[model samples]
Target: MIDFFLAHQRNPHFTGRSSILKDLKGALTEGGPAVLIGPDGMGKSAIAEEHGRVNVTEYDFRLWVRAWDATVLATDYAGLAEPFGIPHQEDSDLQDLASSIRTWLEENERWLLVFDDAPSPEVLEEYLPRPGSGGGGVIITSKSPGWDGDFAKIEVGPLDPSEAASFLLSLTGQEDAEASKKLAEALESLPLALELAGAYIGWTGVPISKYLDIYRKRLGEISGRTSGLPEALVAVADISTEQVRAVSQEGIDLLRLSAFLAAEDLPLDLLVKTSALLADSVEMGLMALDRRGLVRRDEEPLSVHPLIQALAYSRLDDGERKTWADETVRAIGGAFSTYLGDLSTWPECARLLPHALASSEKVEDLRMGSEPASLLLNQVGLYLHRRGDLAGARNVLERLVVLDERFYGRGHPEVATDLNNLGSVLRVLGDLRAAKGCFERALAIEEAQDAPDRLKIAIRANNLGTVLRSLGDLTGALAAFERALAIDREAYGPNHLKTAIRLNNRGEVLQEMGDLDGAKESYQLAFRVFEQFLGPGHHYTQRARENLDSLSQSESD
Candidate 1:
């Protein structure tokens, strides 16, 4: 009798599903076949296993079968026969084995059977005991919702938000109401996600706030090595994705794009832009995904569950991921502004930032220099830099340099541009020597070109001068600044913004060299140019005026 019951692990921290438990007990007590139907991570299997655990002594015999474990449901009776202690006979057919099992069950009184993770109604119907024929009951859990034919059906969903919050609190022994609520909301109240969150929190002793931060930043890595909760969530997602793919390849492609975007309120327009499918075909694909619970589209913008998104991303191979990433960048670039001057488009830009950042990181991993990759790197790098994410900016700019070098080779103008951008980030990070080296390399590249870009050469010289000054090399700094000023004056004339910038650079260098009179003259000239061309309210004009004022104040003192 002990051998008949399979050992099932119970959730130690399970909480708050009294109503479902009552319904499950009612169906089982009546000796009727019952099916628990729901999406993955809803605790359907847990409920079934819990009932089996509690009722282990009531039944004369009990058996558990993983119905989908076998390749051919029709031919695989081994899972069914195993609990009866029946060994496989090479000569016996599946029918004979199934018959022997049925005979054994018929001889037993008050027996129970559970078919966990049944793939579909048709697949399991033949294996199930005939309705009202058995002395005991049968319980099955499935991802399909339409498995209720001639059986009591219980639909399991996410735990109530309060219940989910309570569950987290109980598991972690935390008194934080707000953090628990936030964590529950972030996990979308899924049982598996909650369990994983609790396990991670308990193991790491991280506060709820820090856990949420790590969860967001490392979502794709959630299933890397952890067992139990993460594995369960990923298994469910894999089955769901395979089901969707079996129905429509378009659906699978859509799932890939959704993984790179925000999990909630994902804009369908953006999704459609990424796909090459016709609009109607895209609609059909989304419908297929919706039907499988891989994505939901009841609202205006479609959304995928966070766990599902993470699973989808983790499943892709490198090549397929690069292809999808390229498509994602192209789609977003079509809708969002790549040029930094487009401030009016900022609302949309802000909305796309999370997705863009994620996609840009994927593009960087490919290390290819395609147009879409370049666009993603350029925009994301600039955005991160402007937003004061200096580390993120450096990461993106460093990749951009690699990609530019690969695409255009050394000494190309694009490579020089990439190097200059990286140099700027390095300077801000206070790696003065490294920044100087980057700037010098960029200047050499610019100068080596047959039809050298005079403006770029001037910009690189100015940047190099700034780094040299930071390194306390006053002579090299002044020389570089002078060259920049001369180039800017020749290229764009004295009144241009570039020329004004170069003049300001020279003024700073002169001041650093103790040439107060020369510094004052340079500052005054730069201030006049900036004020006339850029207006007094402009940042450049204001900075130039401040420099001249400092010189006068020092003289008066």
Candidate 2:
């Protein structure tokens, strides 16, 4: 590989694929099976063949077979055996072929078998090692993510921003940083797409943006023969799908559905929930697709290449696109409604929020049932914090705060409602100190706003008191809880259900302060409120009963 690159030195035009070579190095040194999965024209084959030749340099034997061979010639054993100096026997039966190749492979101490553009699983499965035959490490490159082996699965995504820029500038003969950045952005940060655009620009002498506009208008044209290169990009996408379809039509549909997803990654649960297929079936099908290189597996989600997304979008006519968009919105609304309170459901809601907002009649229209849109956004912040997406969550919550203020007024109960929610997210993000400040600020805002709704004020006071308790300011927590209790009692009378919630909150604060007797009294009051308003067997009423018994027993002891 070094000699080849050195021989072609002066052609600094090879861009965005340096990492592919690096991965090849890691895989070869590790000495096991590896599957190189990437989109078309991103140089998967070039890196595999070149690096395999370089690394297995001193091996007793090396074998390379195009994946297409299995589809065409039914098997590659005869061709691969030649390198090991094994001659094909005339009138050899299937048993003879398997025995012959197994013996040859087992004999070689450090052999490398490179399967280039391997056939679909349907064709390749017939030729996969019978038990105990695949003794040595093998490397396979295909358009899809293949199965897990004892080795690694190196998925080659598009180039990082810097690599994409360097590649584009080198190819277009343009050294300007600004021009390259524009081109890179326009090409959607895809390596092959950028390379093709660069070749077109250099050949035609057109400006980068001009070509980008053409890309937007007619992306299909860019993949065809022109600029002295083969239509490699389109050919790769189509051929990979054709191969996948040969094995599983359902897998192809999964890939197509992946293209419909707006986010870069889709979680496993979302896949099962949104798709028509059963969870286990979808999981296996997607895993197969991952092996084939049509889709990729991220840590907790799966991704399709940007170029594949573009191609998928292009394939949809206007009506079909609209239908997909509308159906997606409806799915999102349903998910948000069912799973709003639970934190585990946040990612599902977050993934659906954008599509819902874009296609739904209005944001307000989607905020129905248990999980209203405003509360859904608040939950999104919590999930974002758990995922270490503080900046993103903060951005969304800040905008949500503004929306809340505009719709419900700065001091209105609805606005104060989200203020406490936002503060909770901020606290978990390691700013509990700052979060305490936000709660206090909201309390002040709520107190100043002239609303006749004392229940709203009680809610604000209770929430602020809770924040104070979490911040370890027990004295402040007690005072705020007392104020909330007083307001609730004045507005709804002592035994009202709302007052019971305030009593439970105050009991929690009293418990924090080590006042067991006061906490017991507070819990007793809350239990009575529940018994009167909610009756027995209700979830919250049961919770109140448990708290009362626990607090009373603690006081007795």
Candidate 3:
């Protein structure tokens, strides 16, 4: 006769984590306890629960408990008496009943017990089963870190980028790999948040590409009790917050400030740099946050999960949010070097660039102080332009223009500076007419000032000249260059590099306008200034010498 068989059903949405599962099973097979630990929302509980579900038939009895609090742990322990066949009455002493359950585990074999969402290893000691000759196994899920050396510990972290994207595609039936990858990254590869996003996509049929736009618009709503994400995620964040707050107020402050910055490898020293707080104080705060498993202290540059950042950001009041945003701006501006051509700034700029852009977005959205915003972002835009990311440069500069204009009026000198910087990017991006418009408006703004900033006007004019030259308006180009030269010659004198740049612009326009001797004279003066100021081996000097050689070649031909 054929035998009836049943299969252990698995969660269809669960994917990846094969390696972690292997480590867990290997640890469990030794007739020992295995611990799964990580930050909340990393899917530690899901992983542990999945392991239990699939191995139900392997043990004589299997049980799960939620042990997030002492009361819950006590009640769950007492409630497990019947499962292990221990006799108990409703009115019996709960402590005796729990001890009875523990005794049963000491006596019995082939039983597996799971402690899910354990508050800590200390709180968990009372309820844990002692392995007997019968050889039972144990599993635990927790956000607490540093399990004792006795238990086998498995760490669950964010999913790999590919696996996370695949999970979304599988769950939502989305066929686009790029969109899936984008969504996965935006969610920062956290499992519960990914599940929430995938569920939202499936429920609404919103294209994954459009989901982030909607998410940014509703970040506050989604992070709160009224959420696009499920309540569990918010609960996890709030619980974690309370845990950190209990141990360290400075940690809570740092976490809040972190919410307003980029959600990636934040330098460990940033809290001290931005807050002017003592390093030891910040170190203690970080250690406190780390022990609670709210932040990872092991990573070189500390990281906060993007979802954690979003939730923390949503918890802030408007005024408090603005204050954090200001702090972020100050930090970025203090370190972000604006000298676009300087190589020394590149490493630090690359490190801080992501945070700078994040801070810029926040400052613009809040309409907070634009001066600080510009201080950080102007360098960000310039650095991008220098690095050949014209589109990125344009995006950064455009944000600054809107922010500075709104905060300081259209005609403010700051507005002109933003316009001039943006114009440079637009010019490089092949939007000559748009660049011309930007430059003209900037020049007008600088020219209109009661006490004109001549150096500023010179910058505006020099940029205006190049766009005009690109547009074939050599006459207009020459006039603009001439104005720039006169200002620089007075302010910085004929020997300065600024005066040299104006002379080069002037020579180029003169050559184009068919005045060879005029061009030669201008080039010679610019070449001398470039050679003396920039050194003979500098690229600026080489280019200047090349220009002089070009004029001689024209005469030779």
Candidate 4:
């Protein structure tokens, strides 16, 4: 049976986990409770079973329990007795049977308990200790993080890059190194992701890169819209969420809320407090998440990949998202208001606000007079900017500026900051006239505020200068550039890379205006700044040299 599993494990199809296997061996030999933690299909069960049989003679008895069944209301000792074939005396009660096993283990020097997927921390901590005597140990493989006792936790991260590379090669049966690199990135180097990709590759007999494109399109179907993944891997995460949701409405609520939180290892208290669900519900939901491979919990923190989170969040449609977001926000706002004195709790409040805004009905209502509003606007700006939605980006920043001016007062640096941000969007959209107005307005505000926020002011000044140059207003551009350079030279000293960039910007402007000598002088100064600040080999310095060469060649002609 071990050989059979090993054979299945080795198929080029077999994703390697050398690191996890090594840690498993170390924990088994070290004589302590050991944990093998990872998501499903990463082969935690196989490893645990292999570890159990590694040294048959090392233990007097070894027992594996099917603890995941929800119908079993009994403890591990009683629940495991039938599987272990420990004869139950007709006269003895369940408690007596449990005691007898505990006594037997205490008397025996060798034993092992393989509690595969222990249901909950309460179950493990309250009733699931190893019954065996000295020299024996318990090995648990769980997706959940709660562990009590002196256990060595071995978290199984994704397969190593080399292992992943080899796996991809085998899957596609391809020899190209470039294709392998591209495939690895496509899979996020996740074992399950790679496995899914491999299956898709194997099924289609397509090129690895071609398969990657298909995989992305297929998986991206749910990327931001739904939580359902390909059917093959959905069970891994779905079972976890479903089980936790079944345990209680609160558990279900917690699971739903956690879907919106990041798919990284999260702290236990974070789920407990941030979730609108009850405390016990949160624990069960966590356990369910682990069991299903939707999440993998470790001693330190609970984490989920962006892919998993994407799927989970997709589970909520527009309506569900709105309801969840509303409830999450109200709960978070109340938590923040009531728990203001406890700064530790404040972060949870902060974390949930964005989630609330994801489906928030009234953006202004949620964002008004709040830090969350600023963060939301920034995130919106980022989204728009990435999508080349310059008009949309400008609108968000402009709104942010107006809101800041109304709430934080007219002279607040936030208003100036938004103006600069709006200017940036306008420039990107090629509306240089509007962009210039935005920049000049911001620069005037900065000069008046003079709030000692020189770094920010310097950036705006430099940007405004660039915009002016872009608009063919070289004189105005030159003035703005001079002011920016003076400030940067004072604040960051002459050799700073930012100063170099500004200098480079001015040189480009001079070159555009046909001032060959001035351009050459500015380029040389910029080159010196780059060389001194960022080293001779830096990319920007190389460009500066290229520009100088081009100008020198032109002069020769």
Candidate 5:
């Protein structure tokens, strides 16, 4: 048995890849070539190196090449001359040496060649040995998912929890299962992250239990390794996005935007469509970033790792962070409107919802009062309210009120609008006093306006009356309802839908006050308006009809 050549030895600490090694062996035996494809730092290169280490005795000549790109692949091939003892002068043409090595590979049997971090299958095709000429095996590692039928594709994925925990315990030389499990889960059992965590602990001598606290405080430090550290983790990205930064700055811009949002299943369409940059440039930028494995551009959505987002975010200057945060808020706010919270817009709203909250949080954490954030929170509050998420609605509405006040002043109509919506959410949540307070503040703001908008005044009065009635303040409710009724009558005239809604609201208060005749008249008038304007089949019209029927039943009884 000949001693095979492998440039890097198998990692002494490599863990949990027996199944993958078996798959690699099977794939290499059956194929033109075997490619390990996945997101960057999922241990694709390590596995390939380990596969070579495991099969050392099976082959005569084994070559490990870091085929980063075409030029590097060629250089690696040329350098192979020295290892093979082929005569070559210092000024020998690299092409000639590569050609000679290609010839040698073609003529040999039981030989193995590995291209780690291959730039592309197209570039690699030029360097591989001719098919069916020799019993030689080849393996490749890449971030790209797409591969032609000529290669067998094996996916490198996250390590299982047990495997990850074991790796940590082994590396730290500790027997603490609980701490190891906690640490592994925090890192999501990602091999590269685990390796970095292990390396950090080994170097610092930090116990696994205390390591998590340090990790939280110094995330960038752990993700980007220390001096003289092996290159597994990165602070800015999985792969070098310097080219993306230089050429497709918009692509880097897209990544900056992604950093403030949810890390996984991020809607690709929203990011591309909402970007302020020209669509074509942004698209091209995304492709460039995708090619480098900086952004994991899957078929539907683009996902960023949490570590990627944290690093990208941490790298931004405060000014840059604010600009991008505001941009994110505007993107979500413009897409999500308070007017359309129906089934028609549900899917888009659902997709945009996480991003909206994420943006809101980012701005809030920075203590930056962005006016655009109010718009996003308002629509988010409304959507949550309509979706029967009352708690979520109240929480968002509360944030919106504070933001509106901060950005638009306490007496601004925007603040009134936020207060009104918050009151409605509070009312539904069974907090009558808090609901009444919100409604009262909203109405006071509206009434204090020098020339109040009549429609807005009516809405404020109407919401106040509803909440007042809920609090059992019949007299206060009646006055508020009358204020709304007078405003709507003068502003919209008698038969308008706005008057009808106010009339229906007044009717509810009158009935609660035991004024049967007044309540009946109001219901009849509301029913007439809804039937004439919205048609009898409309839910609002049917609701009024039901109001009348229930009132008649009460009178007959």
Candidate 6:
């Protein structure tokens, strides 16, 4: 049931935007003209095609027109008339052609006309049928938003985040909720970007995590030969960018800087730091960008859509990109605090995490070993680990370790810290051997110093003990725990959480070694300390209680 003189092919994996489709259908059913306006690559034409496909039976005659750059609307009628089997003469007078089209529409009981990719309202104004001239409706899709006179406007934005995520999962036949959501967010929930990503994944059999890596590395370059989305992301971006540049060069510059930062809630203060433009000029530049639909500006911060950010970054030359990327690193890095252990600062750190990761990548790419860059990597890596993104954590922390070792040598305190962090991830990942080696190397480096960090040594010993225990080296684990206990007792007192933790660890090794009475004594002491300092309901106290109970039951048996 497809009637097409010039209808664009529908998307096979088309998903979501039901409400917008409904609204377009409602307008069409009421016999009114509707315009779908949005930025390039937002699937405006696809929605129109889907609407036409679903409602093909409602119209007696259906016509599609490619109104983009159509200088003479009358001459284009021959192409429109071809589908309906209506005879047309190329040499006919323009008025006669118009009369013929009008007469056909009046005679037909119902008909649908879709003016796809209209360049402007003025261009389509001459071609639009008059009110009550036809029974069916007209639909138009355009990049330009100015569709004023007598057309019901539907602003086709990106799909909803949930819908976009579901579309990706369905397209790839994957059931990973986290990865789907992350992919959806990374692509900015744009339908074309999501489609391209899904196509790439399905074609290559790449996991969602690996696809995210490729997408982050080459967002603008990701494309496929999908039916409806013929143009690559970079090509669409180039078109929009050319339009923005035509309006203002400052807008282009603003977008380029935004490309190196996060896609959402970009701080104006951070932008001001990197930009040489005065506050007023920056505001005007943002206004120009906003007008072109390249960026969204709020009261405090500005944001560029994710796809726009990727496109903007892709447009930069190597030298100019390096300069802007460095500036972005400095701006975002300056704002981010390296001390992530402070619970009060976590919200701000989480807010900055995306930008921090972007800036850190730029820093790594340029091999610029500034303090801010180091701090950005360290904090973001730690934050990712805390957030339970183990793969992401491993990637950043591994890079941090390599960089630190290269810059400060293998024996540096920073290298040891990186090693300790990496070891923690390895332990959680169940690589006990690698984790043990990491802890050993960190402990060795720390102990070799004339004036070592006693606290660091104690923490490393505690980590090593746990890994050793997991490897079933009960004696070695017990020794490691005792060393940590001795250090913590001297450094933080016997009642401290660190000391209690070491005591509990030592008790676990003792039980494993079949010294049940010794384990019982150690657990009792640890439990009393935890209850006094952290309360009986604390996790540490409960663990000590369970360990003591287990040991007591074993002795009775």
Instruction: Give the winner by lDDT.
Output: 5
Error of 3 at 241 (Å): 2.2
Q: Which residue pairs overlap in candidate 6's backbone?
A: none
Candidate 3 has an lDDT of 0.74
TM-scores for all candidates?
A: 0.56, 0.41, 0.57, 0.40, 0.57, 0.54
- Note the clash tally of each candidate: 0, 10, 0, 17, 0, 0
Local distance difference test scores for all models: 0.72, 0.59, 0.74, 0.60, 0.75, 0.73
Q: Model 3, range 39-98, lDDT digits (tens) per residue?
A: 767877567667766676777766666565454455456667766667865434556777
Q: How many backbone overlaps does candidate 4 show?
A: 17
Which residue pairs in candidate 2 have backbone atoms (N, alpha carbon, C) closer than 3 angstroms, thus clashing? 143-293, 144-291, 144-292, 144-293, 144-294, 145-290, 145-291, 145-292, 145-293, 146-291
TM-score of 1: 0.56
lDDT for 384 (candidate 5): 63
TM-score between model 3 and native: 0.57
Model 5 is weakest, by summed lDDT over 10 consecutive residues, at: 227-236
Query: What are the C-alpha RMSDs, in order, of all predicted structures?
Result: 24.9, 18.5, 22.8, 23.4, 21.2, 22.6
Q: Once model 3 is optimally superposed onto the true structure by TM-score, how far is the C-alpha of residue 44 displaced, in angstroms?
A: 14
In Å, residue 165's CA in model 6 sits off its true spot by: 32
Which candidate do you rate higher for lDDT, 1 or 3?
Answer: 3
Off by over 4 Å in 2: 1-191, 194-395, 402-415, 427-431, 508-518, 530-557
Q: Is candidate 4 or candidate 6 better by lDDT?
A: 6
Please list the residue runs of candidate 1 whose C-alpha ends up more than 4 Å from where it truly belongs after superposition.
Answer: 1-247, 259-264, 277-281, 305-319, 535-539, 552-557
